[model samples]
Each structure stands twice: as structure tokens, then as C-alpha cells.
Target: MSASVKSPRDPSTSFDDDVWPDSTDVLIMGGGPVGLSCAIMLAQRGVDVLLVERRDFVFRFPRAHLLNPRTMEAFHDMGVAGDIYGATPAHDRWRKAAWYTTATGPGRFDGMKIGDVPAWGGGPDAERYRSSSPRAFANMPQLRLDPLIHRHALAAAPGRIRSRQEVVAIEQDSESAVVSVRDVVTGELRTVRARYVIAADGGRDSADLLGIELEGPRDMREVVNYHVSMDLSAWSEPDALLGHFLHPAGGARRRGTIQALGPTHYNRDSEEWLVSVAAWMVEGDPDDEAALFASIRRMLGLADDHEITMHSMTRWSYHGLVAKQFRDRRVFLVGDAAHKHPPTGGLGLNSGIQDAQNLCWKLAAVLDGQAPDGLLDSYQAERRPVVAWYTAHSLENANRHPPIAEALGFCDDEAAGFRGLEVFVSETPEGEAMRARVAAEVAHNAHDYSQLGVEAGYHYWAGALVPDGTPVPGDPSDPVTFHATSRPGHHLPHVWLDSATGGDGGSVSAHDLIAAAGLTLLTSESAAPRWRAAVAAASGNMPITVVAIADDDAAWTAVRQIDDDGALLVRPDRKVAWRAARLPADPDAELTAALETILRGGDAPAGDPAEPYLRRIRAAANVLVR
Candidate 1:
């Protein structure tokens, strides 16, 4: 059966002001996807959460559209993926992206497909993702997504997120953070205090409050996004995908690329559309209404009298930046507060949601007294390097676009621009060369479309991860191709097992067996009883669950690359913290020591071989005592 779809903000439901407590365990700023996610995860963990958003309602604009597998897996873990899938109601074919010369009259130029992978699976990485997660990539407009998350956040913890509430000032010391919030409609102010705060509030303004500076390029380019509703049915084809790329045309002064927001098939009678006009703004105003409209109309091959209704126009500056520090004293940054990048691969929202996933469980553990305060230091140590890689990858994806334009002789920087486009479509030797180069460029950009490795292959090397003596595996040369493995410090490999099924007989991802907040132990049935006993004995304060498979489950064991008698310890985030090739002489002691090491941010028992690695992490986190 499909998951039931319901809005938490049903008219019958009530979210009164009293639903939130005066004081909370965690205070999250911003009610964007990241903040809402943090609130939902924290509330689900039984943490009192309060979230404040300056906006009165969720933004109803098309923003991030690509929800990668990892983000879907995180939503699945939160038990919201099905609702999100249901909310989208778009087919796999609609999710595919194609480049077009013009939306008004296509087929004159052959289409260049970009998003080749199926949205709901049957793509090249389908089996791998099927093994790793129960969820797949989703291409839903952010306008639809934000409400689902907003409703979920409120449902999980009613009144936790108060909209139209602006955070005025934040004061923090060694123990807690005091936040001053103001009512947007009424000039009322109230102060709330929490032991820890999450700056999920997007933009660099929040960072400024903490005296943090963003490091890296502040602006890559400026774009004007036009939300238009018009009769575009005449321009669409049965094979057209959601994304349409307008080739450079209309001479240098009038030449600019336009992206059609599609394969959104609005009803023909009431056709509505959204598109962005992007140009290198070296001179003149980027937001000149008359100029912007002409550029859009020309790119679409529309006549001067074409009827187009404009709803709204927003000018935005793209940035490739990361906060100099993710953490400052008692406050920690997440989402756009920590990093910003071009949306070439649609990693912004995905990374932000995962940032909440990474920090939520750790915060819960520490708050519950299952871990020490020092464990907080791992947040930056583990997330910074990932953000750095994503920033560079986003930059690379953005940089590759210019080469395609240059190869097509559409170099806007040159005195003669897009004049070669005529020759590019001709039957001459130069045209053939341009065609080959364009095809090669399109193929070379496969990573920008199917970024499985960048989305799923990033393994946390520090923070609460306990590295075994085994050497860590290297990532693929291509940032987007993933290799699943279960080495310590990496995500546990995925495998299908009948024991993971239920009365319905639907197969489950090994990941589904793990809980949202606990240590999961996987071992053979013969050792299951012992491991369970060890877990029971060792988990005096921490949460741990042990599962022992039958000795005949060789296939699953092989996927894990562990002996039937061996064991693997998985953290709450579905990452392998420690693994034993075989049961140690003292199972309880070994398991107990591993738990302690992880809770203490990779500390090891005296004489343990991993002590050196732990020391290095300590130095990087800056939490080591003199």
C-alpha cells in the first residue's frame, strides 16, 4: 500500500501558542527545510524544540528541485519520504532534463538529454540505491516541498516553529545562548534561552551575528528568475523533459540563455510556466524589466506580440562560499548558514537537510548525557571537509558550462557572439566538429546530472567515527560515481535479506533495520545471543540493538564483507563505527570500549592502535586538553 498522504496543518488541527514550551532544549533559527528538518528530528528524539521563522508563510516559489538519494534516505529515516513522494505526483519521465534551442519551436535542433536516470529508479544506479536505501531520488518543486516539511515539523512538535517571528539578537557565553525574537506584525519582543542553538537561518546575515565571515567567492553570477504563466502547450513535445536550455542566439547585445521550468505539464487551457534569464552582467542593470522580457521572449523564439503573464521577478546572486567556522561557542551553523554554492547539481538543499541529520542525533546523544560535551566538537571536524568538497564540485560544474558555450562559438566575452551558431547548424566540416564537441561536452557532464557518488559516497572521517586499523578506501576520481563499502568510518554496505521482511513480504533495506537513535549490531545467529547479551550489558546508558542473522545468510554477510561469526557496529546515521572480523575473547569488554571511544569523540583505550588517529581528530576539533 502507498503511504497515506495528509497535511499536518489540516483545518481541523490546532497549533496554539501554548503548544511550545517557554524554554526548550534546542532552539533552531529559520523555518526553511533545514530548520524544519532539525526540529522534526529533534522533536522525534523527544527533545523540546522551538523554531522561529521571519516569514509568515512558507515561500511558494520554485527553488531546489532535485532531492538526491541521500536526502530521500534521510527523509525516509524521518518517516516522511512517502509523503514527499505522494506530494510530488510527477512521473519519472517528467523528471528527466533535456536541452533545447528554443521552447517556442523545438525539433529544429536535436535535444541534448541531461538527467538520464529515471526518477523512481531503473537507472544505472537503481540496484545500488535499492540495496542502500528504500527511497529514490525525487524531483519535486521546492514550492510544494517546503509545506510538506513545514507541516511535518509542526506535526512532530506543535507550535515549535513560529512564523513571522524574527530573531533580533543572539547572545551566547560558555553555557547557553539567549535569543531575542520580535513579532513581525506587532512590535513585541521575547527572549528565549537554550543550551544549544542551530543557525539553520539561511544567508550570511545570521553568520554575521556570530561574528563569522564567509570564506570563498561571495558572488559567482547574477540571475533574474521570472515566474510566468502562459500558454506554453504549443511549445512542448511528448518527449520534452522538465529542464529546457535555450541556446545562445539573437546577436551579442540581445543574446542570452534562458532555462524553461518544465517538464511540468500544466493543463493546456491554463498553461503556467516559470523560467530564468541568465546573462553575464558586466554592464547595465540585470533587473531592467523591459530588457529581461525581451531576452526571455527571444530565447523562446516568440514573436514580439506573444502573450505572456508575469507573476513575479526575483534577482539573486549565486555564491560559492563556506563559513569560516561552522561552530562558534554555544551556537552552530547548518544549511545555508554554513555553506552556499551554485545550484548546478542541486546539492544546496540536500546538503543542508543532511547537515541537520548529522547534527540532530549527536545533539540528542549529548543532551541525554549518553555522550560528553566534547562530542559537539566533531560537528565541524566531520562536516567542514564535506562542505569544502561540495563547494569545489559545485564550482567545477558551473565552470564546465562556459566551455560548452565557447565550443559552440557562443562566447559572450568575445566581440562576435553566437554568430557561429548558424555555422554550428550547417552541414560543413566546422559544423560537424561543433556537433562532436557539443556531444562530448554533454557526455562529459554526466556527473552534473547523476551525482550518486557525491551524494551517497561521502564518508565521515572524523567526529564520532571510530576508525579501525584498516586503511580507509579512496573515493572515485569522478566525484559523482559511488562505490558502496562497509569499512569502518564508511556507510555500511547494503544487502537484501529475507529476515528483513515482514508479513507483507516486501523486502527491506538493511538500513531500515537500524533505529533513528541507537547503535545497531549485526551478526550471525550463532553469535547473536552473545552479541545481544554484550549489548545489554554494555549499553547501560546508550541505546543499542543487536540483530543476529541465520548462519546460512551467506549472501548478506558477503555484502557486508564480514564473516558469519563477525560483527559490525553501525551508528545512528547508518555509518559503520566499528567492526569485528570475529568475536573477541571478551565480547562485552570489546563492545563497551568501542561505545566509550565513539562517545568521547574517538578516544581509545590505552594501547589501542587507533589512539593515534583519535589524537589527530582531537587536534583538528580543538577540544584536546593541554
Candidate 2:
């Protein structure tokens, strides 16, 4: 999985359409994390998929530094969460973020703690809540992680993921998409026909090709990132990534260096550095290396004798944008292709990965004849709002400025300032209330996955798959915010339960339980008989698990109460397709209606054996060729 490994397939080689299958179930246009996740999900479901990437190999950029809990859950489902955990470099989970008046200014604030939770017990369930099993936010750089994902995708489907294949054109009719790709290294063109095409080509290329416009602020200022090697033990504090070198007088613009890269472990050999510096613009010849070198030297407090090694220089603009639509006909967009946000929150890559996961299961269900054709529209319905939410939130996070010290009631009068400090810390109710409010605000600011359930918890609220009731307030369209309560259409809350009901209290992880059940129908034991009977009627037609749980756990209890009769039917993609107090007598018919409502575009439901729809589509294509 080294970054230097080249593509195994020769550029001169063209996959012979006559020798192989004439069409693919899905064509994925980027081999990055998003596309790779899509490929893995499809291949896992036994779908014929073709994945192409313009890059010669896996990503080497130092982007996407953290993996939140929701993403960990996704990796768990993929069976690679452990591999990712093992590969990540060991580092302190709780680190500080420093902010300065300016990029070069002296530090105005100390370390600000982000995310940390205290342990309550020791077990898988405990780990799920407290242990950071999948890492709520880990510091492993994407340069090291992307290769692992790429390898996993290729391993998931041998001879499926094609590297160095640049997609030049995509055309789709009502039934299939034809894509033209050129081997970037060999200059050979090949046509691939697929039932669906996913464009993960980021914003620049795929957006333009699809005639999609990105509406948002462009880069008003250029930020330069440098990966460098240096010894900062003399001045740098441990675990401090941002160091501000404020102006001596404190009234002028401050400038400082942002630590963009760090060692996975504390090993001296493993130690590397990524520094970012920003300014309005470089004066006196923009290309002046001396100016850049001087900025680094001043920021780092470097001495004349200090040795330095620079790895790479990258320039990025602060572009915040979302595509008008994630899909146009058979072609769909995900990840950076659908949206781009400021990297301040490290949500871009993680959000993109979620996008892939959301789309993958629906695509698999449709292609595998498990779900109807209309099910595909829900992909856009559910994910587009998420992109918009994260983009706006990320922009807000980027723009947030630390509270000025003066705002803490400190005054110019030295005597008055001391009195103010005493009152602020002492028995004054106002002072105590202010302090508590500030602390609570800071804790609230800590980005927790409570909102993740919203992002990942998204349910289809539009098109044929629209859920019942007035769209749940803040359903998929609302901005993501941390809320402990589980709302309808939100990600099923993570809770540990006693897996062994008859014996002593033994707990199992929520993720493990869900995976074991395959497709979980969470409802009370009282409803199990009816649900089981309903599922039995559709026995040969659908494959799902009926999980009956007591209304003891808080989240599930709330879901049960609000959903009525404690019965909720969850799709394989972990979305709630239908929920009711009891299954109808004709359970198969009711289930069919729900499925058709979501997947059939209000057209009359398909007759028995939904397999014919998929078969007919493919068979008709073959007839056209004949």
C-alpha cells in the first residue's frame, strides 16, 4: 500500500467488450474514498461494478486528518475498521488548537480542547460510547489512509478498480449510461456501458462536464501549505500544533504557523511537519522564495544554524460550494463533486465518505432486485441536504473567532480589572452564571456526532420514497447540530444492550448487533409475531432480520413511543422505510406498498417477482444488440 506503487494494468491494454460482459451494473468514475466505498458496497452485494480513477495511484495529499464515529460504523460494516485502526499512527486523542491574531501574530489563546469523553466501563459497548473504537476523530493523515482504502477496494473486487483511466464523456438514456474513458498513460479510448454512473471527479472536472455550476465564494486569499522537517523542542510546546507569533505591541495584524502535519507516533524518525501560512498577498515579486523562507523563519523562531527539509508546497483556495443537484439522469455525483467546504472542521472527506455509503446500498438494492427503481431518487433526496448542511456549518466554523479577552469584563483600569477578576471567580451570581455559561458554550462547541446521526441519519423525505407525517422537523433539510435526542428519520441512536437476555447482563456493541441482524426490524417483542408473520408472507421475495427489543433503552424507547406500537422497519441502508404499531393482516401487500411507494415513482406497483423488472431491462438491451 505504499504511495509509490504503480497501477497493475497496462495503459496499452483495452478491456475487450466482446470477450467480457457488454454492460456493468454500475460504473464508478473516481477511485478515491467515496468511489471506493461505493464499489465495495456494490461488489459486496454481488453486483458487477467497474471503478475508474484518473490518478495514477492512491492519494498522497495531507488532507482529511480525522475519522469520526459514524465513519467508523461504516468501516465496521465494510469489515475494514480494524485494519484502519491498526494502520493509523498512535497519537494523543485530545490535542489543542491554537489561534493567533494573524498567521504570524503571537498566540492570543492557549490550547482549546475539542472532543473527549470519560469512560464508564470496559467492554465493546463501553468502547462504542467511550473507547473511541473507530475514532471519533483520529489524527491519521489521509496520505497514509487513502492507500489503505484503495487497496481494500481492489481486494474487495479483483480486476475491477481501474487506475489511470480518465473519463472523457458520459451519455445516458433512460435505461443505461455509456462512458468514454481514455487510458491517461497510453492514450487509448474505451467505451463502457453501465446501468448507472457515479461521478466522483471532485468539483472542477465532473461539475463542468455535467454542466453543473458551483455557486459560492471563490478563493479570496491564497493559503500556502508546506511540509517541512524541523526541531521545535526549544520553543514549541508538546502537542501544540498552532503557534502564534503575535506582534510585540498587540495592536497590529498577527502572523503564525499552523502545524498541518505531525508524526503518527512520537518517534524521531517518524516525525514530519506540515506548516500553513497565509497573508493578503506576497509583495515585491510574488514568486520570491526568500519572502516565503523569511515568513517560515520568523514564524518558527528559527535560528540561522537550524537545518530544514521541505517535502512539498501546496496552494489552496477557500472555496465553499455545493452542486445544484447530485444527479442528472443516470449520472450521479458524490464527495467533492457534489460539494466542497472549508477544511477547518475536517468534515469534507468524512462527509464525502458518508455520501458514498448513502448511495451505495440503494444502488445495490435496485440492481440486485431487492428494491424498486424509484429507490434511486432517494439517494439525492437524502444526501443533497446533508451536503448543504455541512458546507454551511464548515464555513461557520472557519469564520468563528475566539472571544477577545476584553469581552471577559477586563478593563483598562488596573484596580478595576483586579476587582472584576475577583467578582468573576467569586460568589457573585452574575459572575458564576457567566462562567458556567461560557463553559457550557465551549462544551457545546465541541463537535460531537450527536449531529452525525442527522448527517448519516438522513431519511428520504422527497420523491416517491417520502416518509409519512409532516416532514420531521429538521429532517434531512436542516443544518446538522449536536442533539442527544433521536428524531424520526435520524440515525438510529447508538446504545448498548444486553445481548444475552436470559443470562447475567452481557452487552454487545450496537454496530455488531446491527451487522449480525443484516437488516434489523427494531420493534417490541409484542410486535414480533405480527412482524415475523408479515415477513414470512414475503419470505422468498425479501431477505431481512426481525429484531425485537424491549422499550428500556432511552433512544429506542423514544423511537418506539413516537413511531407507535414500537415497530419500525429499517432498510439495509439503515434507513427507516416504514414504521407502524402493527403489521397489516396482508403483511406482504403492506410491505410491497411501502417498497413501491419509495421505489416505483407512484407508478402501479410491480407484480409478483420484482426480478422481472431488472431482467427485462437487461434483456431488452441484449435484444437491441441482436
Clash totals, every prediction: 2, 15
Candidate 1 differs from the real structure by a C-alpha RMSD in angstroms, to one decimal, of: 7.2
At residue 287, candidate 1 shows an lDDT of 55
- As a whole number from 0 to 100, the lDDT of residue 27 in candidate 1 is 89
Please give the CA lDDT of all the candidate structures.
0.68, 0.56
Q: Report the Cα lDDT for residue 489, model 2.
A: 46
lDDT of 1 by residue, 1-626 (tens): 00111112222123587443456678888888899999888888877778888887647677776787788988987778998777553554444445555656533442322212332233464675565555677766676788888888878887667888888888887878888888888878888888898999885357668878876665456666777776655555443334445355422222233333443452222244556666642235555666666766666667766777776777777666677678887788999999887776778999998888888988987887767877777777677677766766766665555455556666443434345666677799988888788767655556676666787787766667677777655644466566777877678776667566756888766777676676688888898887877876775466777776778865576677787778988877888888888889998899888887777777423443223333333232232111
- Candidates' TM-scores? 0.86, 0.75
Candidate 2 residue lDDT tens string, 1-626: 01111122212123442233457888888877888887777777666788888887746566666676667677777776787767554444224443322231233321222222211111122333342222343446777777877888777776778888888888878889988888888898889899999888785457767898765555634677767776655443444443433322222222334554555533223356666665532335435665665666655555545666766667787666766677888888999998876665567888888887777777766665656667677666666655665666665544332222232343345445345445545688988865665445333323322234333444433433425554454443233332332333445555555432323545654434343212455666676676666666652333566777764555356434343344555555455556554555676677656655655532332332222222332332232210
Model number with the top TM-score: 1
- Model 2, residue 509: C-alpha shift (Å): 2.9
Error of 2 at 142 (Å): 0.7
Instruction: List residue ranges in candidate 2 displaced over 4 A.
Output: 1-22, 89-93, 100-135, 240-257, 266-270, 281-290, 402-481, 484-486, 500-506, 515-519, 538-542, 550-565, 581-590, 601-626
State candidate 1's TM-score.
0.86
> In model 1, which regions exceed 4 Å deviation?
1-15, 18-20, 105-132, 240-271, 279-288, 412-432, 472-475, 603-626
The window of 10 residues in a row where model 2 has the poorest summed lDDT is: 1-10
